[model samples]
Target: MPLITLQNVDYGVGGPLLLDDAQLSIEAGERIALIGRNGAGKSTLLKLIAGELQPDDGEVRREGGVRVARLEQEVPQQAHGQVFDVVAGGLGELGAWLAEHHRLSHAQPLDEAALAAVHARIDQANGWDAQRWVEETLTRLELDGEAAFAGLSGGMKRRVLLARALVSRPDVLLLDEPTNHLDVPSIEWLEGFLKRWAAPGGATALVFVTHDRRFLRALATRIVEIDRGALSSWPGDWDNYLRRREERLHAEAQENARFDRLLAQEEVWIRQGIKARRTRDEGRVRRLKAMRAERAARREQVGNVRMAFADAEQSGRKVIEARAVGFAYPGQPQVVRDFSTVVMRGDRVGLIGANGSGKTTLLRLLLGELAPTSGEVRRGTQLQIAYFDQLRATLREDWNALENVAEGRDFVEVGGRQKHAIGYLQDFLFTPERARAPITRLSGGERNRLLLAKLFAQPSNLLVMDEPTNDLDVETLELLEDLLADYPGTLLLVSHDRDFLDRVVTSTLVMEGEGRVGEYVGGYSDWLRQAAPAAYGASSAARESAPREPAPKPAASPRRKLSYKDARELERLPARIEALEAEVAALTEQMSDPDFYQRGGDAVQAHGAQLARAQAELEAAYARWMELESQGS
Candidate 1:
C-alpha cells in the first residue's frame, strides 16, 4: 500500500490556485524529487503530504499508524534550548515522559508511581534509547550536542534540525532544499545517508525539493513536478525526467496547434451569419462556444526567468593578479597562503572547497576588501567589480521591491536609455502589484530574483558571485547559466552546486583546507577524476601531460624459485609499508596546519619533497608485494 495519498487535492484561496485537482501517491521505499518554478507550490504540496496543511477540497489519506517528518528550509525560532534537548524533541511524548521522570527523580523521596508511569510511556513510545540515538546522530552531522541552540550559526542550526528529523526515523521524510548552507563534505555525507535510508528493504520513503542537480541525480528514483497547478510524475532519475518532460511539452504544443486550426474553421462558419443559421447550424454554434470556454479555462504555461546583464566597458587583459598571496588573522595561523593566480578578462573561474577552506577569503583578498599578509595583489585600471553576496545583504526589508531595485534613483539605465523602475522590474517577471509589495513579504526565491535584478543593473567588467545559486528556483538557475555563459566580463564564483560549476566555469580553483590551493583545467567533475585514489599515484605533471590507461603488470615468477633474500624482504615489507604510510600521514597533517605554512619556503619545499619520496617508495613496495602474492608466496 502507498504510504501517503492525496486525492484530487484543491488548495489555496481566492488568488490563482496553487494546486488544483492534484493527485499524488507516495509508496514505501520510493525516493521522489519534487521540482517546479518559483512560487509554483512545491513546498505547499510537501506540507500537505506531511500533514502540516490540509487540502481545502479533497481527502489526504495515510496508511494506519504511519509517521511523517518534515525538514523545512527555515529553522524554528523557538527551538532555543540546549541542542540535545531540541533534537530529543523528535521523540514527542517519550521526550516529555523522560523529562518528567528526571524531574520527579530529583524531588524528595522520589514518587515511585510517577516514575513507573513515565517508564510505561517510554516503553510504549519505544524511546528508551532515544537520547543516545539523538546524540549519535548529532555527532554524525557535526553538531555539538552540549551547545546552546541560540549560539549556533544558521547553518549549524539547520543541521541540528535535520538531525532531529532523521533521529525520528519516520515512515516518510519530506525535505526542502536540504543541501542549502551545507559544505561540500556535508552534502556528500547527506547523499550517502539518504541513499542508505532509501535502500531496498527499507520501509522509509522520501520526497524532497532541491535545486542541487547532483543530489537529484544521485538519490531521486522518480521526479514529481508541479507546473501551472497541475502535477506530473516521471518515473526515473534527473536525466530521464528532463528528456521526458521536453518530449511531453513538444507533444502538447503540437496538440494546441491542431486545436487552434479547428477553432479558426469554426470562426469562419460563424462568419456566414444568417445563411448558416438558416441551415440549422445551432448545434455547431453551441459546440464552438464550448470549445472557446475550454480553451479559456486552460492555464498558460509559466514563463522562464529572463535575465541579461547590461553591456559594460571591456577590462584590461590582466583583470587581477595575485603574487604569493597569504592571509592570516592577528596572532593566528594563515587560512590562505602562497596562492598565486592570474585572472584575465573573460576568465570564468570557480572557487571550490570544503566549508571554512577560505574560498570566500580568497575572493575578498582578490577584490581588495582584505589585504594579504604576505605578497602583493595587482588590479587592472579598467577593473570594475560587481559582487553578489549570498546573504542578499544589499536588499532593504523596509522598502518595496521597486524601490530597492532603483536604489535612490528615479530611473534605471537599461539598453542605453532611462527606463522606469517599475518597467524594469516587469522585465524580470515582477508584476506592478508585486513590485509595490514590501521586500519582507516576498518568498526566498523571489528575494533571490530581486537581488539578481539589482546586481545586473550595474555595469561592471568583473562579476564576483558567492553562492548565488542558493534559494534560486530551477528556471532562474537555467537563466543565470544562460546569462553567465554569454557574459563578456571576468567571472569568479564560489558555489557548492557542482552542476552549476560544471555548466558555467572554464576552470576551477580548489582550496584543499590548509593553505594549499590547486588549479584544475576543466570543471568540478574534472577535478574529481584527477583526485581519485588511482589517479593519486600519478604525479601532477604526468596527469597533466595526458590521460591514459594504467600499464599492464609483468607475469609473476614461480614462488618456489624465490631466493632466501627475497623471502626475508617479503616478511619485512609490511612493517616498511606501515612506517612509510605513517610518515606520509604525518606530513599531510602538518601541511593542514596554517602555522606550518608560515615557515620559510625552503622548509615547506623540503617537507613536500620528503612526503613525495615516501609515497613513491611505498608504491614500489606495494607493487613488489602484489607480485609476490600473485605467485602464491
Candidate 2:
C-alpha cells in the first residue's frame, strides 16, 4: 500500500491556482525527486504530503500509523537550548517523557510511580536508545552535541536540523533543497546515507526537492514534476526523466497545436449566425461553448528562459598570474600555501574544496582583495573583473526588483548600448507587476535570477562566480549554463554542483584540505577518474623497462639450493600474494559502487589508502615470485 496519497488536490491562496487536480502516491522504499520551475508548487505539494498544509479541496490520505519527517528550506526560528536537546526534541512524546524522567530523578523525594510511568512511555515510543541515536546522528553530520544551538552558524544550524530529521527515522522523509548549505563532502555523505536508507528491503521512503542534478541522478528512483498546475510522474533516474520529459513536452506541443486549429474553426462557425427557424442546432452551440471554455481554462505555456550575456572587452593574453602565493589570517594557521597557477585569457577554471578549504580565500587573493603573505599576484593591465557573490549581499532589501537590478540608474549599458531597466527585467521573465514588488516578496529562485540578470549586464573580461547555482531553478540553471557556454571571457567558478561544473568548466582546481591545491585537466568526473587508485600505475615507459628478465640457468645439482631464510620467504610468498590480490579486488569492487565516491572524506580516503597499500604489497610479492622462479628456470 502507498504510504501517502494525494487525490484530486486543489490548493491555492485565493490567487491563481497553484495545484489543480494533482494526484500522487508515495510507496515504501521509493526515492522520489520533485522538480519544476520556481513558483510551480513543488514545495507546496511537499507541505501537503507532510501534513503541514491542508489542501483547499480534496483529500490527503496516509496509511495507518505512518510517520513523516520534513526538512524545511528555512530553519526554525525558535530552536533553542543545547544542540542535543534541539535534535532530541524531534522525538516528540519520548523526548518529553525523557525530560520529565530526568527532572523527577533529581527531585528531593523521588517518586517511583512517576519514574515508572516515564519508563513505560519511553518503552511504548520505542525510544529507549534515542539519546544514543541522536549522538550518532550528530557525529555523522559533524556537529558537536554539547554546543548551544544559538551559537552555531547558519550552515551549522541547518545541519543540526538535518540531524534531527534523520534521527527521527520517519516512514517518509520530505526534504526541500537539503543541499543548499552543505559542502561537497557533506553532500556526498548525505547521498550515501540516503542510498543506504532506501536500499532494497528498507522501509523508509524519500521524497525530496533539489536542484542538484548529480544528487538526483544518484538517489532518485522516480521523478515527479509539477508543471502548469499539473503533476507528471516518470519511473527512472534523472537522465531517463530528462529524455522522457522532453519527448512528452514535444508531444504535448503538437497536440496543443492541433487543438488550437480545431478550436479556431469552431469559433469561426459560431461567429457565423444561421437562421434559427431553418437550422436551429442548440446542442452544437452548447458543445462549442464548452470547448471554448476548456481552451480558456488551459494554462498558457511559458516560453523558455532567455538569457543573453553582453560581450566582454578583449583583455591581454595573460589574464592573471600567481607566483608561490600563500595566505594566513591573524593568529591563525596558514589557510593557503604556495598556490601558484597562471590563468590565461578565455580559461574556464573551477575551484573545488571542502567548506573551510580556502576556496574563497584563494579567490580573494587572486582578485587582490587580500594581500598574500608570500609570493606575488599579477593581473593583466587591461583585465576587468565581474564577480557574482553567492550570498547575494549586493541586493538591497528595501528596493524593489527593478530598482535592485537598475541600481538607481534609469538606463543601463548593455552590449555597447543604453537599455531601459524595465526592458532588461523583461528579458529575465519579470513582468512589470512583479518588477515593482519588493525584493523580500520574491522567492529564492527569483532572487537568484535577479542577481544573474544584474551580473550579466556588466561587460568584463574576467568573470568569477562563487556558488552561482545555489537557489536557482532547473530552467534558469539551464539558461545560465547556455549563457556561460557562449560567454567569451575568462571564467573562474566555485560551485559544488558536479553537473554544472562538468557542463561549464574546462578545468578544475581541487583544494585538498590543509592548503594543498591541485590542478586537473577536466571536470569533476574527470578529476575523480584521474584521482582513483586504479588510475595510478606505472607509466608506459616504466612498464616497458620493467619487463621480466630471462630465467637464470639451473644449478648443476638436481634440486635448487637456497638459504633457510630464502626457502621460508618462497614458501610464504604465494599465500601473501593471494591475500593482497584479494584485498585489492575487494577494495576495487567497493570503489565501483556509486555510493563509494559519495561516501566522501575519510571513508573514501581510507579506502584509497588501503587499495594503494595492497597494490604495493602485491607488486613486491610478484617481484619476489619472479626472482624465485628465475633461479631454477
Candidate 3:
C-alpha cells in the first residue's frame, strides 16, 4: 500500500507555480530522493507530504495508522530542557490526552484502579523509556554521554535532533539535507544507519532531500525530480536516471531541430512565390501541424551550468611544496606532522583523510593561510593559488549573489589585465535576476555553487579547494568535474566525494597522522589499499611489509610446500584461511552491491582487497592440498 499520496497538488506564490499539478505516491519501504534546483520546491513539497503544510490545491492522503516524522529545523523550546525531556516530548501530547481521559472516566474520588490504569497506559506507550532510547540513539550517533547538550556544537545539536526523531520510530521519515554539517566519517556512519533503518520489511520509509550525490545514489531506489512546478519520476538509481535523462534530452533536441528545419523550409517556399496552397495539400499541412504540436509539447533541456576558470599566468613546474610540515594549535599536540608534499603544474591531486585529520590544515599550508610549526612552505615563482573554503560565511550575506562574486571591486589586472565582475559571474551560471537575489536567501547548495563561480572567476594556476562538493547539487558537481577535467592549471582538492575525486584527480595526497603525507600514484582508490591491510587479509599485510618475492614456478613443488609444525599451528591455519576467504567474499558482495558503487574509496578498496585475498587464499589452498597429498603418499 502507498504510505502517502499527493494528488494533483499545486504549490506556488504570487509570481508563478513552484510545484505544478504534481502527483506522488510513496510506497512503504521506498527510499526516494527529492531533487531539484534551490527554489524548485523540494523542501516545500516535503513539508506538504509531512502534513506540516497544506497543498495550495488538491489533496494529500496518508494510509490509516501511518505516522510521519520530519527533522525539525527549529529545536523545540523543550529542546533546551533536559535531553531526556526533549525526546520524551514527542509523546508528551499523547500522554497528556490519555491522562485527562482517565481522570474524566473516574467521576468519583481518585481510586487505585484508575491510577493503575493510567500508569499502565504510560508504560505501554513507552513514554518513561524515552530517556533510555535517547541515550542509545545518541550513543549510536556518537554523541553519547556528552557532559551537557548546551555545550555541544551546532553539528552535535543537529545529531541530537536526529536522534529524537529517529527514536520516535515513525512509519515514514523525512530528512532534509541530513548530512549538512556531518564530516566524512559521520556521513558514512549515517549511510549505514539509514540502510538498516529502511531495510526491506523495516517499519520506516525514507524520503530524503539532499544535494549529496553519493548519499542519494547509495540510498535512493526511486528519484523524484521537481522542476519548474512539475514532477517527474525515475526508476532505479541516480546513474540510471541520469542516463535516461540524457537520452530524453538528446531526442528532444533532435525533434526540435527537425521542426526548426521544416519551419525554415516552409518560410523559404513561401518567399519563393509559392501559393498559400496549404488548404489544398491538407495532408502535408496536417503533418507539419502535428510536428509543431509535438515540438511544443517537448520541453527544452535545462542547459548545463557553465564553469570556466579564469586563465591565469603559467607558474613554474612546482607550485606549492611543503617539507616536514607540522602544525599544532596552542595547548594541544601536533594535529599534522611531517606533512611533506609537492603540487606541480597541471597536477590534479586529491587530499583525503578522516575529519580533523588535517586535510583542511594541509590545504591551509598550501595557501599560506597557516604557518607550519616546523619545516618550510614554498611556492614556486609566479605561483597563483585560489582557495575555496567549505564554509561560505566568508561570502557576503547582505549583498546579492552577483555582488558577492564581484567582491565589491571591479575586475582589475594586478599585472596588466582588466575584466568586469558581472562577466565572470555569468560564466558560473548566474543570470541577471538570480545574481541579484541576496546571498542570504540562497540555499546551502546554491551558496556553495556561487562560491565556486566566484573562486573560478579569479585567475590562478593552482586551485586549493576544501570540501568543494559539500553542499553542491549533483548537476553542479558533474559540471564542476567537467570543468576541472578540462582545466590546464594545477589542482589540489580536499573532498570526501569519491566520484568527484576519481573523475578529476590524477594523484592522491594522503594525510595519515604522525605528520606524514602518503603520496600515491593513482586516485583516491590507490590510497585506501595502502592504508588498511587488514581489509585485504593478514597474509596480504605480511606480503606488503616484507621484501618483494618473485613468483614461484608452477613446477616448483618444494617452494609451494606447506610446513606443518605443532598441532596448534595446523589447527589455526585452516580457520584463518577460511576467515580470509569469507572476508574476501563479503568485500566482493559489498562492491557488487549497488549502494557501494555510489560511495567513494571504501567500496573500491573493499573490492580490491577481495581480489587480493582471493589470490592469497588460492595459493594457501594449493599448498594445503599438496601437503595433504604428501602425507597420504
Candidate 4:
C-alpha cells in the first residue's frame, strides 16, 4: 500500500477546477518533483498532502499515524526567536511547552514557578525525547541553537526551517520552492542533506515544488505534474520526463484536431435541415449534440510564454573594464576586493557568490553605478544598459501589469517596432483581464514576467540581470536561457541557478568571500569541475585553494599538448578526486555529530581545521583534474 493516497480528488475555489477528479499515490522512499505553472494548484496539492487543506470532494487517505511536515516557500516575517525554540515549535503543543520551559529557564530574573510548571508539562507529555530530537536536528544541520533566527542569513534560515521539519521525524516531507532564497552553496548542502534524509529504508518520502532545475535533476526520482485540473505522473529523470511530456502533448493535439474536424463535419450535416430531421439521422444529431458539449467542456492547454528581446545596438569592443576594483563599507571587511575584469562586446559573464557575498554590488561596480572604494571602473562608450533588478524595484505595486509595463503610454517600442502595451503583455501569457489586475493579484511568476517585459521594452547594448530566474517556471527559464545564449550584446548576470548559469553564461566570476572574486573560463558547472569541493559548501577551503585566474585578457591562447603519460593521469583523476571527496565527506559527517562540539572548543576547532585542509586538497584535485582534461600533448 502507498504511504498516502488521494482518491478522485475534486477541489476548486469557485472558478474553473484547479483539481478535478485527481488521483495520486505517494509511496515511501520516493523523491517526487511536483511541477506546474504558477497558479496551477501545485501549492494547493502540497497542502492537501500535508493535510493542511481538505479536498473539496474526494478522499485523501494517509497510512495510519504517518507523520508529515512541510517547509513553506517564504520565510515567515513574524517568526522571531532563538533557533532552537523555533525548531521546537514544529512539535505542535508539546513543542510549545518545551519552548516555554526553555524561555522561562533563561529569563533574566528566573521565574521559578513558571519554569517549574512548564517543565512539569513537558515531563507529563514525555517531551524530553522531543527536546533531544530538536537538539540533534540543530546539530545535524550545524545551526546555532542560541542564535537569533532573524540574525541569520537567508541560507541559514532555510537550514533552520529544514531542521524544524526534520525534528518532527516525519515520514513524509514537503518542501515548497526550497531553493527560493538559498545561495549556491546552501543549495548544494540541502541537496546532500535531503538525499541522505530520504535514502532507501530511511522511511521517509520527499515531495518538493521547485523551479531550480539543478535541484530537480539532482533529487527527483519521479516527476508529477499538475495541468488543467489533472495529475500526470512521469516516472524517470528530468530529461525522460521532458521527452514523454512532449509526446503526450503532441498526441493530445492530434486528438483535439481530429475531434474538431469531425465536429465541423457534423455541424455542416446538422445544418442540412432535411437530412438532419430524417429518422435515420436522429441518433446522429444526438451524438453531434454530445460532441458539441464535450468540445465546450474541454480545457484548452495554457499557451507558452512568448518572449522577444529588443534588438541591441552595438557597443565598443571593450564593454567594461576594471582596474583592481574594490568596495567595502567603513569598518566592514571587503565585500569585493581587487576585482578586475574586462568584458568585451557580447561576452556573457555570470557572477556567483553566497547571499550576502555581494554579487549585486559587484555588478553595480562593473556597471559604474557605484564608485569602487579603492580602484577605478571604466565604461565603454555608447553603452545603453538595461538592468533587471532582482528586487523588482523597477515595478510599481499600485499599478496593474499593463501599467507596470507601460507607465502611462498605450504603446511601447520593442526592437524599433511599436507594440500596444496590452498586446505585449499578452505575449508574456498575461490575459487582457489579468493585465488589468493589480500587481498584488499577480503571482510570483507573473511578477517576474512583468519585470522581463519591462526590461525588454527598451533597446540596450548591455543587459545586466540579477537573480532573474527566481520564481520562474522551467519552460519560461529555458526560453530566457535561449534568448541570453543568442543575445548579441555584453551580458552581465548574477544568478545562483547552476543550470541557468551553465546553459547561458560563457564565463563566470566566483566570489570566494572576503571580497576576493576569481574569474573562470566557463559556467557554474565548469567552475564546479574546477572547484567542486568548494562549491559543495566549503568556502574556507575553496578560498584557500582557489585558482589564481584573473580577469581574462582577450588574446588567442594555445592549448598545451597532452602526452601519453598525461592521458593516463587524466584517466586516473576521477578515482583520485572521488577518494578525496570521500575523505571530505567523512570529515563533514564526523563534524556533524553532536558530540563533536560537546568535547571541547579546541577539539571542534581542530576538527574544523582538518576538514578545511581536506576540502582544500579536494579543491586542488578537482582543479588539477580540469586542468589535465584541458591539456593536450
Quality of model 1 by C-alpha lDDT: 0.80
Clashing pairs in 3: 20-229, 337-515, 338-515
RMSD to the true structure for each prediction, in A, is 14.2, 11.1, 10.0, 10.4
Task: Write down the lDDT that model 4 would get.
Answer: 0.84
Question: For model 1, how does the per-residue alpha-carbon lDDT over 564-601 read when each residue is reduced to its tens digit?
Answer: 87777788889999998998778766654535534553
TM-scores vs. true structure, each candidate: 0.80, 0.79, 0.72, 0.84
Q: Which segments of candidate 4 are over 4 A away from where they belong?
A: 107-109, 273-280, 531-633
Candidate 1 vs 3: which has more lDDT: 1
lDDT per residue, candidate 2, 1-633, as tens digits? 667888899999766788999887776756889998888888999889999999999889998998999999887887887777778878876766765665577567879998998888788887768867876787877788668899876667878888788888789999999898677666776787788877533577899999998789878866888888888877535765688788878998899999999889877776776654357478888888898898888787655556766666699999889999889999988888888999988899998776766889999998899999999999986887888988889888999999987888997777667789898888787989899998999988888888888887877889999999987888788888887877788999999897899899989988875666788887776666555312222123222323333546676656476677887888889999999989987776664343443343345446545765788889989999888865642
Among these predictions, the greatest lDDT belongs to 4
Of 1 and 2, which scores higher on TM-score?
1
Candidates in order have lDDT scores of 0.80, 0.79, 0.69, 0.84
Candidate number that wins on TM-score, 1 or 3: 1
lDDT of 4 by residue, 1-633 (tens): 467889999999877899999887776766889999878899999999999999889899998999999999888876789998889988989988988887887789999988888888888888899888888888999989899999998889989988988889998999999998788778877887888888533467899999998789878866889999999876536887898789989999999999999999989887777654574567888999999999999999887787777876789999898999889978999988887888999899998888887887888888777989898999998999998988899999989998888889999887668899999999899989999998988888889999999999878889999889988888889999998898878889988888899899999988887678888888876786566445335444334434544656788468877888888888888998899899877876564343443344345446545765787888998888888876754
> Measured by TM-score, how close is model 3 to the native structure?
0.72
lDDT of model 3 at residue 259? Answer: 77
Q: What residue runs in model 2 are displaced by over 4 Å at the alpha carbon?
A: 93-129, 139-143, 150-156, 273-280, 415-418, 532-633
Q: Write the per-residue lDDT of candidate 3 for residues 1-633, one digit (tens) a residue.
A: 567888899887665677778887776556789898666788888899889899889999998898888885344554654344344345556535343433445446667776677667767776555545555665776664423567655556666777777766688899888876565555666777787788544446899887777677778867888876888777636776888778876896787788789877865654454356543466766766776676566544345566666678888988888888888888887877777777788999987766656777777777788988888899888877787887776687788987777767877232234556666566555667778887777776678878887787778988878778766667777888898898788888887775677788999877656656678866655555445523222234223533333555577345344445533455566776776777766654553343443343333344444565585786787577556655431
Report the C-alpha displacement of residue 170, candidate 3, in angstroms: 1.2
What TM-score would you give candidate 1 relative to the actual structure?
A: 0.80
